[model samples]
Target chain A: MTWLRLALANLRAAPLTSLVNAALLALGTASIVLLLLIGEQFSSTLARDARSIDLVVGAKGSPVQLVLSSVYHADVPTGNIVKADADRWAADPRVAHAVPLSLGDSYRGFRIVGTTTDYPALYAAQLASGRFWEAPMEAVAGAAAAREAGLVQDRRFAGAHGLVDGGHEHAGQPYRIVGVLQPTGTVLDRLILTSLDSVWNLHGEHESAHDNHEHDHDQNPEDEHDHGEAHEHDHADAHDDARENTSMLIRYASPLAATTLPRQINTESQLQAAAPAFEVTRLLNLVGLGLDGLRAFAGVLILTAGFSVFAALYGALKARRYDLAMLRCLGATRTELLWSLLLEGLMLAALGAVLGLALGHGTMELIGRWLAASRGVSATGWVWLPTESWLLLGLLVIGVLAAALPAWQAYRADVARTLAG
Target chain B: MTVLQIDNLGFSYGQRTVLRLDTLTLNEGDTCAVIGPSGCGKTTLLHLIAGLLQPAQGSVAVCGQRLDALDASARDRFRGHHLGIVFQRLHLLPALDVLENLLLAQRLARVSPDAKDARRLLDALGVGEFARARPAQLSQGQAQRVAIARALVHRPALLLADEPTSSLDDDNAERAIDLLQDQARAVGAALLVVTHDRRIRGWLAREVQLEPPA
Candidate 1:
């Protein structure tokens, strides 16, 4: 038998120890691999979805919440900003491009976004079939939205009132699906796009009813009489600029707009401008602490695995001294014996590496499926980050280092003394 | 043809000499016993012949190649091809089966695996039925037969056995010596048995005695 075969046989002879060491290494490797998968998918998905849009302008609230609602459709909007104010900003010379987002409804938990064709253009989306919506009540379904909700071209479906399912459905005001978008691998894939008037007209009567009902309730006199007039005055101001959008996604015309525009909007208007790049960086930084903690835990596990491998080899070597001498008597060179021991360590590491990678990717795919089901944002396991290769390299190094002492002992062993003893 | 020649060989550990031999020669198909009490360096003589140690003085040659003139690795290669040693303990690797033990011997000797020859050798030693049996599963006699088969599988120029029959009864000891002589003659190898067991002296025609270090 070759030295490698001998090494493998030796490992098989101690199946439990070999398996435990391999499994420990696998656990550490899988953890690191999973972390890389999630971290890379999160950042890359965020980057891809937010590439075109520079800033999100919305009703005064947290900039992060505005970006989440308007750009990602992940959270509820901070509230609505007047469409007239957004229109004036879009007409500004510094704004290169703008898309109005009138969000507030969902169909089967997928958001129905009121946007112009420019929204699809923002993601460079293309039609899978049919055409982009050209009129009110005509909708273009994103790929995921189309597939999930069964929104085939020419089909009509009404949306629920809120961002989530189980809300009141506007059954009478159903929209015709004019087109289905190809998968852009972006946030747009989870949205249904329509003319802004579709949202405004649909909410028109509902808004007035809600306003008057609140007005009557305020006049109840027992319910805080001091705010009754203030409530009515606020309703009148809302009616004066009745057309409103949840947010405006904007792209700057020049680098100067980056410096002045968000500050200008925040100070001069009743709106908050959130830079997607800045918000994304802040988001990653916020999540970085947890990622770092998991990374450190993975490092500790790997270190422990290395130590366990060393201990196992050292222990086994002590028991196998006679075997080594026997091999020497059988004509094996000292180097050959040394390599046999080294091969055992490397084989264990190799087994762990293979098992770890498969476990990591499989677990990530399961998580991706769950995330896709709930949030409409999936992190795929199919992606292989470059750092994963480095992970394998690190494991091999650990295997070698763990085996080094045992191999040296085997090499330096006095065969005659050992055999006689 | 002469298979082993030792002349004025000396070996030491630190400040003490362990072994000194004036001259000894053995030819192909020859059987000899180096007999002595314990600590008389009989095993050391086997080691020196196997090129497992560098002699401090004079020369030990196997198949006409001087072992002391070779580098460590070269000596290892020479020993692998020319020498087969059976330790007193019959140290068969527990991980390998009886058959794999023979195969491993061939592998370490850098000889191409001849499964037929290995199996035939095992059959010759009356351990053919235990070919697949692990060393731990074998009786002491069966393990000894397997160890002998492993040593002769590659057809070495010289076969060295250290206390091959010390653990056996008189009948088994005579049988062990007969097996060694027969196998060595079958492979045309010079046979040298190193033992403190005086019963072994009567079994072999040619004998040499090693006195304890003074």
Candidate 2:
């Protein structure tokens, strides 16, 4: 009780230094917590979304790119495989179901994925409003896509080419929003879903108009057609191409299909097959390398903080030499003196650790709210506190050792000469 | 029985010998004053008796236990249990209040003195009103009294004072000497005061002067 009182009194005497130390510890702890939460959320989201699909078949490129484009709707596909090849793979005995996907268009920066109704059932997505697309030009919106673009059922928008800054209007092939999916806390929530025929038709119509413009220039050189005539020709061709299909999404009956089908397709046909689980593992490895680097950096920071604690206690000992000698004169044994100094440091570290925990949790909660609003993902904040407990315990141990070094020095001080001077 | 015994005790820092005492003994309840010129080893002899330092070629015994035979922690423990020390500069911990500073001594000695005893000790020292004030907030004479209160709080068997009157005027010095002596006599402890000042030598029961080393 006496030592505790002394420790508390010492802290109160130097509130500014204590506060500074606590703040630094809090900042480091908060960074570690935030990074851990975000990394866990990202990895778990990828794992959960990739669990349902056994294989993703798309154009030949990076397997990671294929999964990102076909399943997650994150990046553009390398190129398209013929719809005829997709129909052939669906007929294979090992295949459970096949859902075709066409990408390359966007609405307001969100990638528009042209996929079938089978995609929602495969991903186990629930419809929050209306129904899935039933027609060529109709679209189903993910929760994030709908909320971000303010697209309700029956609202129409002209799809653009690619996910770039500008857009080339689809002329007559305007898409009507038919359904909005409930938030799945995955990347799927940020994509626009529609029939693969829509994307293929949009591109096909684009190519036909290019040919028509050249034909018009060759045939009618003297009489120039008005803007309305050219626009009508583009629309007519767009409607005609809307019935043709593009690439397909495949789900295997077992894990063996992921290895067998992609290899078989690449060998037997022009189509490419991608395994989402395999690609996700590769992705995790990439992310893990970065996380390991950050962990090393955090290790250095904690080491520096430990040294700072040692330096602070050492300086305090020097400044308080007379006080220690006085205590020695007042019947305090060297052991008691040393223990009192050690207790002071332990108290400082414990207080800083507790404050760091609160600060980390508070910062995580703030970030979780912002992420939930902007990215439509509810980051789990509770998962980080347990890991932070280990960090706090480590800091406490370092603090004790740091304090002991100075206390030992005080124990060896010459009491009589120190008092005399 | 003698509470403290020093025989042929010699100590030095580097090449110079600062303290050389042929023989000294303090019986229980005796108040002895040690006076000397500047650079004389009066404080060093007190430190030797308090077990704060090792003697060069002789031995110091407090309460029948040889100081040289104990390890650092044991020596410290023995000092806390048996010796009370007052310094010329009045070393009270700046972080602790007057009462807390006094209580710290009892705590280090592991002596459980009650609040009533503390109050009585403070009252007897004439600084009871400053009990709650920090050492820095007290006047010089009040801090000196607090130091005296701290030194005697554990009821040690031997009390060592090193020029405790250096910061006090004649009147305060006389009062401090009387209070310290009265407290030592009340607790039945031997008092050894080392001082260069000669004003309060008559107050002690006996006086010893250290000449030059030769």
Supply fnat for every model shown. 0.69, 0.63
Model 2, span A1-421: residue lDDT tens: 8778987887777788766766665666666666666777788888877767878776677878888877766776767765545666776878777776667888888888777667777668999999887556778898988998998888999888877537786757799998899988777788888865566557756777433433433354222211112212333444322333335666677767666778898888877777788888888889899987887776666566667767777888888999888677656677777888888778877776777667767777788788889888777566654666688788788778878889898878888678666
Candidates' DockQ values?
0.66, 0.49
lDDT by residue for model 1 (B1-214), tens: 8999999988888878888888999998889999888877787788889877778888899999998788877777778788988888888999988899899899888899998999999999999989899999999999999999998999999999999988999999999999999999899888999998998877887999988777
Please give, for residues A132-227, the per-residue lDDT of candidate 1 as tens digits: 765567899988889889999999999889999999988888999999999888899889988765676578648764344334432442331121
Query: How many clashes in each structure?
Result: 0, 2
Off by over 4 Å in 1: A126-140, A143-162, A165-183, A206-242, A252-270, A370-378, B14-16
- As a TM-score, model 1 comes out at 0.88
TM-score of each: 0.88, 0.83
Estimate how well candidate 2 is docked, as a DockQ score: 0.49
TM-score of chain B of 2: 0.95
Worst 10 residues of 2 chain A by lDDT: A223-232
Q: What is the DockQ score of candidate 1, to 2 decimals?
A: 0.66
Query: Which pairs of residues clash in candidate 2, taking residues 3 or more apart in a chain or in different chains?
Result: A99-A249, A100-A248
